[model samples]
Target: MKKSLITSLAAVLLLSATAATAQQKSMGGMQDMPMGKPATGQSVHMARGKVTKVDAGANLVTLAHEPVKSLNWPAMTMGFQVKDKMLLDKLTVGRMVDFEFAQAGKGYAITGVK
Candidate 1:
């Protein structure tokens, strides 16, 4: 009986560990991979934030954005590359924007803004 009980307990522990690993993967394992790189099929995320800075010459915009639920990110300020330099024309420091972005090579890229 003791042997059977030990086997059952071990099985349960193994299953629990497997579940935890799966949960971490589903959560994006962001710490293991570069930030903004989502798992397959999670291509886009929407966020709203104030434009903190715009580097038109580099096509980058820095924003103090609200939490990004899709990416499981808390509110934070970060820079994103714009898909087009022209997108910079619509962004101004201190202005609030609603934007859509996707994971680019090693960073995030803004696909649209409103």
Candidate 2:
């Protein structure tokens, strides 16, 4: 009876360990993929913010933006990409403007500005 009890306990412990390892592998798989990138032709999210910095050379504009409700993003400062260099000309440091952006990859790309 003691031997049977020991074997049963060991089996339970092995199952628990297997479950834990499977959970860890699933979690790691999630991290390996990018989750937030928007689909192609997704609707742009409009947001208003000040142009904190503009890097015309890099075709990037940095903005301190208000909460983006459509994307569930909170107010924060981050750089965005512009497909056309001329778009950066419309932005200036400390100037407020409304812009539309969609996730292009791991980052956002400006689709329109006003």
Q: CA RMSD for every model? A: 17.4, 19.4
Q: Quote model 2's TM-score.
A: 0.63
Which pairs in model 2 have colliding backbones?
A: none
lDDT by residue (25-102, candidate 1, tens digit) is: 676655432234444444777889999877675577778899877666767777777887778887999999998887
What C-alpha lDDT do the candidate models reach, one value each?
0.71, 0.67
Q: Could you estimate the TM-score for every candidate?
A: 0.64, 0.63
Task: Name the best candidate (by TM-score).
Answer: 1
Candidate with best lDDT: 1
lDDT of 2 by residue, 1-113 (tens): 96786555545434543553355456453322222344464666788999976666556777889977665555776777786677787888999999888756545678778
Pairs of residues clashing in candidate 1: none
For residue 60, give model 1's deviation from the true position in Å: 0.7
Q: Give me the runs in candidate 1 sitting further than 4 Å from their true place.
A: 1-42
Superposed by TM-score, candidate 1 places the C-alpha of residue 83 at a distance from the truth, in angstroms, of 0.7
